[model samples]
Target: MNKVLISADHVITGPADRVITRGAVLVEGGSITAVGTAAELDTSVEPEVPRLACPGATLLPGLIDCHVHLAFDAGPDPLRAVAEADPGELATAMADRAEQMLAAGVTTVRDLGDRDALTVTLRDAIAAGTATGPRVLAATAPLTSHGGHCGFLGGEVTTDDEIRARIARNAEQGADLIKVMASGGALTPGGPRMWQPQFTRDQLRLIVDEAARYGLGVAAHAHGTDTIEHCVTAGVRTLEHCSWRTAEGIVYDPPTARRIVENDIAVCRCVSGDWRLFLEQMGPERAEAMAGVIRDMRKEGVRFIAGTDAGVPGARFGDYVGMLEFFSSLDFSHAEILDMATVHAAHALGLTDTGTIAPGMRADLIVVDGNPLESLDSLRAIRHVLTAGRPIGM
Candidate 1:
């Protein structure tokens, strides 16, 4: 059995909230065997085992992205590009995107959208050791209304029968979860308005029920206030882009926020890309309006998971650390933000063994040069990354 020992100045164990100084982790095969201070276990390991020591670094669980679109190329015209590419071509691009994400210490990612169910192919390849990338939990194709948000992906379902059939097809394809576009989006021109609800309450409930029958959780993409409320009532597991937009302006519905908390539904704000560019595109007034709504949601005790929405236009893969500024801007502590990217995100994705550093857990971790708890910027200083006890060649 191959064994490796890694010791760091500080080890964040269990969750981002816990830390052990001068800590060491022992890995045998692909699982963690022991985690404790170097002085406690260094002498007990086999003398022939290899050891890596970083005196001024911190080790923590590998990051998890709850929302992403691996099929989109993050190009200026991702939709056009996706529409033009065949499945084989799209899979190649997705593999490159996956490698980029792994380089940035994101060892696990939940792909919320894809075309042709290609993400499932990539997910299987990674699991079979034929690819070098994060462990993927992919939603084959997102359900959308006719000409609604992302309807071009070919998952448009109108009637209850269509919805059930689509859900069954995705489950047959080995989807890890189900994604439903419950509201209109800004990405599709001439589609429903961004503040418009795409699906009726009954349709949304049908999606939730059908997905539950397949033992798959539903992730609802909701921006409008009505859509958000519908998703909550439908009992979806997670809400993506819950911006609470309206025709007049952003609204902070306290009752809906409380309902989300009561249901324990995870929310992925999907904030990413260059902040400066985002501000310029959104304009100061619109940006501030959206930010205010998000701030209010945080105040209402909504649970947040960090997701970059990578592969979207301007939201490049491998830039996950840069997106941390958004949470910091909301006055989230470093530990809290890290939790959103790690433990909280893992739980949201239903990953049991990949998010925390503990005995018998998968050895997915990253070592940075400085203390991330003190400075979030340290996360960018990635000295090493291990996925399933194997080093990522950066």
Candidate 2:
């Protein structure tokens, strides 16, 4: 462990807390040991500690992305890119993407899909200091029907034996969580329709229980109404892209929404930086309808976890601030949106130590040129990013 003193013009300790002016934090043993006015820390910290000062910047907890795909290229044809690349090359590319995320001030990410647990290897590499990347929580390969969405990644099961075996295998591979594609997805050509269910109610329950055997939470990639209902009943810890999709348009099922709120299942809406482009592609009327649904869900006590679905088509690892800005379309204030990315997302992912910049918290912090509480665009002016007290390579 190393010691470092970080001082900034302003520091945001939590989303709800008032900004601390002339703030300084002491990092020791990869954790924050002190947080207060820079003047107080100037005398309290040992003289041997190295100090880094940002005279006109705001310091805050590092951003967290709840859903990302380290395997895809974020290109016009992400599937083709993954399909065409060699295994070793794909892993190398994945490492590069993680570094991109790091440079963008994303300190933690939950990688929901990758081929052959490549993210697991990358996670370990980053942890061991052999690679430069964000702290990764990998889902390895998302569970799906034999030919369902993202089946090419190799998580496919049809029978009870196969399902249990795969879950066990994922646990063995050190997956932080289990990801199940509960419904069809646009990314998988020839797969079931987006509104179609991939698993029966009984099968969904089985997957949840099997993952629980390993003390792992299950995150479901659910889009349709019925499947979202199924996921809620099955106790999924997180719901990815719960758009309430149907054949004609988006549907807002009030009762299911209530259940999701009551059960406290965090929703990752999967909006990316190119949301405005998507809005144009989806048409204004549909976009308005979806926005209404999002607002209603928030009103019903559903706060979203920030996710870029990065590496999907048109979603880049470098524009996470853009994704948070998209939340404004749903009428969330800058403060509310900031919580969704930091403290709220940390809780959603069961990581309690890394979200807020407070004493005893992990030293995962970022400093930017302007106050993010006022304008999220300030996040784009990243001055520094540190994970576990070590400054990341920009």
Candidate 3:
């Protein structure tokens, strides 16, 4: 068994609200053995064990991205690229993308979409130590209506039997969860408009039922108001985007928002890292409308998790820290923002062992040069990262 002790100036542990100054964590066999003030742990470990001491840094649980697509290259036309690349080429690109995510201190990611079930292959490779990357909960391919959003990824299913069969295929392929496209999207040109509903209420319910039989949670990609209502009524576990878009404009349905809060369904609002560019593209009127909707949701006490929607145009992997700034812009406290990336995100993804620094937890941690509680920009200055007690070469 390998053992290592890491000491830092401050340690943020468990919930984002708690911190320990002059803290140290002991790792044994890829699990945290202890977490306490450095003085308290100084004499408890073996003298021969390796120790890493950083005098002015903060240690935190590795960040989690609730939604990402490892297969897309963040190019202007990721859909086109996916269509052109063979399976091998897509897998190689995904491997490289995963490394970039690890380097950025994203230690866990939920890949919500991919081609040829490539994300599952990368997920397994990373688990077996054959590849270097974050712990991945891969969806393989997302279920979409025929010719609906993201239909080109080959997850288009129309009938009830087809839906159940597709769900079974993904489960057999080792998918950690299921992703369903509940509405249209901007990425798929000439598809259903962004505010248009794709899956019927019955269809969504069937998907949730089938996924539940396999003990897999269903995450719905919902941007339209009608679609969000459908997903909430269908018992989906998580709602991605949740933009509340209508053909007239952005609208916040209080009843739907209340239902989401009451049911404890998590909402992943994937703000682009280049938000300023996004605002410019969206123009002032539309951006303000969207921000207003988010503000209303926050006021309604909806649970929000941080996700960059990485792999989309203008949203790159390794930009999770930049994406945090979007939450900050919404006037969220730094602690609340950190919780979204760590504790809340972990709960959303059903990852119980790796979200926080504590005894019995997986030793997935990151050290930064400054205090993220005071300034989120500090997170970008990553000094070191450990995933499952294994140091990632920076």
**Model 1 TM-score, 2 decimals:** 0.98
In order, the Cα lDDT scores of the candidates are 0.89, 0.92, 0.91
lDDT of 3: 0.91
Model 2 lDDT at residue 305 = 92
What tens-digit string does per-residue lDDT give for candidate 1 at 1-394? 7688999999998567799999999988888999999888789887788999989999999999888999998888888989999878888989999998998899999999888889999999998899999999989889998988888888998999999999999999999999999999877878898779889999999899999999999999999998899999999999999999899878879999999989899999997758668878888898988888778888888889989988888889999987888888878889888998998888888888978899999999999999999998998999888888878873
TM-scores, all candidates, are 0.98, 0.97, 0.98
Score residue 262 of candidate 3 by CA lDDT. Answer: 99
The per-residue C-alpha lDDT of model 1 at residue 204 equals 93
Q: By TM-score, who's the top model here? A: 3
For 1-394, candidate 2 gives per-residue lDDT tens digits of 6888899999988873557899999989789999999999999998889999899899999999999999999998887898889999999999999999999999999999888899999999999989988899999989999789999888999999999999999999999999999999988889999899999889999999999999999999999989999999999999999999888778889999999999989999998899999999998898899888898899999968999999999999889999998897667888888888899899999998998988899999999998888889999999999988878753
Model 2 misplacement above 4 A: none
Clashes (N, CA, C under 3 Å) per candidate: 0, 0, 0
**lDDT by residue for model 3 over 1-394, one digit each (tens)?**
9898889999999587899999999989888999999988889888899889988899999999999999898999999999999888889989999999999999999999987788988998998989999999999889998988899898999999999999999999898999999999988988899889988999999999999999999999999999999999999989999999899988889999999999989999998789988988899998888889889999999999889999989899999988899889879899999999999899888888988888999989999998999999999999998889888983
List of clashing residue pairs for candidate 2: none
